[model samples]
Target: MSTMGRAGQAPMVVVDGVRKAFHGVTVLDGISFEVAAGDVVAFIGSSGSGKTTLLRCIDLLEPIDAGRIVVAGEAMGWHQQPDGRWVRDSERELARKRQHLSMVAQGFHLFSHMTALENVMEGPLTVKRLPLPRARQLAQELLAKVGLADKAHARPSKLSGGQQQRVAIARALAMGPEVMLFDEPTSALDPELAGEVLATMRQLAAEGHTMLVVTHELAFAREVADVVLMFHEGRIVEQGPPQEIFTRPAHEATRRFLARVTGGVPQPTGSS
Candidate 1:
């Protein structure tokens, strides 16, 4: 995909006409968007609207059939050959490119056996071959950033669900990714716990991290997103700043979906 933004600054993440499908059913149909550095872009819609699938495509967990995805000017999955033809990337090459991103799913995907600190440190230690002492130091700092410093020694089973997810976020941060992809990061948490996770995310956004979040939490999208995308039938039906999209949606599907989930208008009154 082509990069965007003012004069010299290229967009951090670019998805141009990307498409994905499963068994003849299209999940993402020629969806395109660009996220500038430090921008928070939220994908919101009803269930099965392809919100999460779009996140998967950006992270390269699901390959796109057509179009391109780029993060920090690095192309994913495919590369140019000497003859000018494009070819699918090798497993090793794909793995290397995927390292530029950090993905946090709705589910906490931590190693059950490792403590919170160890779980966070695993990536830097193994993937980057960082020294153990340096990795542990960074891991502790990230755990503190996520408000899980006190739970560093606790394993996944020992911590509450919210704390586990926080650890997952910390683990992702450990790798120092250029773009963070979150797919319903708080979907599995209760309201009280979800607030804790959202608070951490808000802090990250304020600190200038570029992020792509797929969420059903209208309040978070309204407050934290620089842009809101309404997905329908595998395409972005409408998108704009949160104010325009939430208060005066331009698309019928956007209006209907917002009305149904939000019970009317999706306005945030400072509560998550």
Candidate 2:
């Protein structure tokens, strides 16, 4: 795919003919897509459909076997040399590139010993080398943004699951990423608790943060996503706007998947 978007602007994220496998089993088969800045793209699929793996690959947590990924115009994980050979990017180079993007996985993964504020501040303070005062200020602002101002002093053990995930979102935001990746951010919570985290994510979407979400929350995907990708057996069998993909899916695989996940409840074209 061309690095330049249709309007000649560089796309925020690009995955071109990407393929990934584990041992001898294919996990992602020639996946390709582009995410424009500020767009919310949702990846929907059943378990083991390569959704989470794709997010991990984009974050460079896992390496792709083939194809390329470009984020904010910089190649991720690996780079081609003048000799026409592909080489893994140096650790320092990958680290530098990683600062441009952040991934919020299903697990909160917060520091058990730290307060919410401290957990959010850890990245800016350590990785970005921000001053203590500035880092604290940023963390506080983020906590408040995620509706956790009062929970700032609370440790992970003291906060609810939803609150912890919100803190994780805040921590991801603290890095000032160009793109945010969420791997089923609400999966671990009960519906009521998941609603809280989903609300924060909706707020982020409203604020125009570019996001790539792999979620089972069809409601969120239909309402919030600018584009929906339906993954089947490691490939995107169907992709389109929420209206097309949810209400009138073009592929039989998509229709069946939606039927099973949505429990045959008709999907509305827009948010409830």
lDDT of 1 by residue, 135-164 (tens): 999999999999889999998999988898
In angstroms, the error of model 2 at 272 is 6.4
Worst 10 residues of 2 by lDDT: 1-10
- Candidate 1 deviant stretches above 4 angstroms: 1-4, 265-272
Backbone Cα, N, C clashes tallied per candidate? 0, 0
Best by lDDT: 2
TM-score against native, each model: 0.95, 0.95
- Report lDDT per candidate: 0.88, 0.91
**How high a TM-score does candidate 1 get?**
0.95
